[model samples]
Target: MSMDPKILAFDVFGTVVDWHGSIAAEAKRLSLPVDPNEFAAAWRNGYKPAMAKVRSGTLPWTKIDDLHRMILDDILKTFNITSLSESQIHELNLVWHRLNPWLDTVEGLTKLKSKFTIVTLSNGNLGLLADMAKNAGLPWDLILSAEVFRHYKPDPETYLGVAEIFNVLPEQVMLVAAHKDDLLSANACGLQTAFIERPLEFGPNFSRQDLHREEFTTYHAKDLMDLAAQLNCK
Candidate 1:
């Protein structure tokens, strides 16, 4: 990389927000008749495999919203949840739109935005990402998603597409994400990668086992604030 990246594309779900806590809280509010933590874990465990079906052409190119709904239905059955009406289920599946940002998210992004374009590169659909930004006061310069590229993480297209969209080389774009799978994929496509440590992404009591540094990324930090400092952002 000859210069600092012009854009920092982030993975939103666990990277910027507390999805597990949000979902678990929502579940508890609804009186789901199951342990909220276990419910959240079961729901999240189905995420990647669900995306894999779409990525491998086994399932149609379904949006994350629909995929989430599919997983929700399966888990509802897993937990024997039969009380929710159709409308309730529909609204409940939209909980991803209301996820809460991490403690330093808004401020850190505000700081990073002072230095470079800050955007999102999540698997979440555009509407979901937009609503999350508005709800959480996430200061995104622009939003990019798998919906835009019709591809998900681990696909070279999603990583390289960010550069093409901005008219820059891949190296001039950096992907800031908590997942190594995401960073490794971006790195393989020649984009710089920054790994953010979001240890409580799954839940508050859960200990993350994959916070160690790897050679694939250009930088690693404890959170977005740490990432901003490492990047020399105010």
Candidate 2:
């Protein structure tokens, strides 16, 4: 790497938190009729297409909370789950706000914070990220989101927005994410990129075959702790 990043922008959902496991646990706790794992997978599967609609102007700028509710309603019908009341459904949609962090998340972020300005770069809205940060005890210097940029990940605006906010060159910001496409997009925008491996991001039923190191990334780490070590953060 030519220059060490001053800002470490994180991709939140799967990279920092265990979304699949958290959702599945919540569903099981609620005693939903559908298989919890399958239910969680179905909900997450809708995320990209929902965002794509916004990107293509098929839907107006809708925050992730609304998008999540929309997906939840559709999946409920698909699973034939009609027992939950309106209040129950609404509360369930807020699972994103209550997601549990990966075991290494808080520690890693704390360590990294001592070295760089740590902030979120998630598609999740500000409120959602804030609530999650509070709930998970995540130590973030800032919570930036697609809602703030009005553009989702893989979009140049969202990646470059980080640099613009901090008044720095794109290469001075490193995007750390679990998804390859996200890192590739950041790399294309002249930002440093780091890939965080999350083999069980989708749940135990599914296997991610692309967890290996990729040429596009400046660093490829096993998890946030590993990333902290690689960055020499104590």
Candidate 3:
């Protein structure tokens, strides 16, 4: 153990849980006419651009729940899904709050929790992350979000804020995420970075070819369990 980092902040969504899988499953269960995979992809595709509007001040700061609803509305329109009632659509929008964790999530997080403080550093709003953690039985020491910092991932404020919240140096906090962009931002903020690969994050059909060895990451692992083993968390 390095004994340098007292805190390990995680990125949720694809990092902690399988968002695409969960959404697709929910869509399938709802008997949507469209392919579940395509629906999931279409919904997620709207996320970044939606967040970009907030990041660039093109739109006012918005919570992820609202952004997700916005995207869901767009996808429903695109798919010509008008059969479902408004209440059903609203419930569908909350599927993100009940996403399933990766198979190794609980065990790996439990192992790491024994060694260091584990918290969420996701762009998700507080309610979404809290509901997901509770629903998935994720063992988190704390739940921090863009809602807490009023800033999203890839933003220096969000990364450095973790250290600030814990009264530690930037290097004393490590960011564990599946996205290179997220890890890169934390690296720029002087935090240690770990890349946890979620190759199937997008879905089985969509392969993420961008999972390359990167100089920015302090550690690279296949999943949360691999990360725990590499860190000697046990």
TM-score of each: 0.97, 0.99, 0.98
Query: Candidate 3, overall lDDT?
Result: 0.92
What lDDT does each candidate get? 0.93, 0.95, 0.92
Indicate the TM-score of model 2.
Answer: 0.99
**Number of the top-ranking candidate, with lDDT as the measure:** 2
Where is model 1 more than 4 Å wrong at Cα? none
Lowest summed lDDT window (length 10), candidate 1? 1-10
List candidate 2 segments past 4 Å from native: none
Off by over 4 Å in 3: 1-3
Q: What is the per-residue lDDT of model 1 for residues 1-234, given as tens digits with 9 covering 90 to 100?
A: 236899999999999999999999999999989999999999889999999999999998999999999999999999999999999999999899999999999999999999999899999999999999999999999999999999988789999999999999999999999999889889889999999998889897799999999988898899989989988996
TM for candidate 1 is 0.97
Report the lDDT of model 1 for residue 21. 93
Residue 103 C-alpha lDDT in model 2: 90
Query: Which scores better on TM-score, 2 or 3?
Result: 2
**Tens digits of lDDT, candidate 2, 1-234:** 567899999999999999999999999999999899999999999999999999999999999999999999999999999999999999999999999999989999999999999999999999999999999999999999999999988899999999999999999999999999999999999999999999999999898999988889999899889999989998
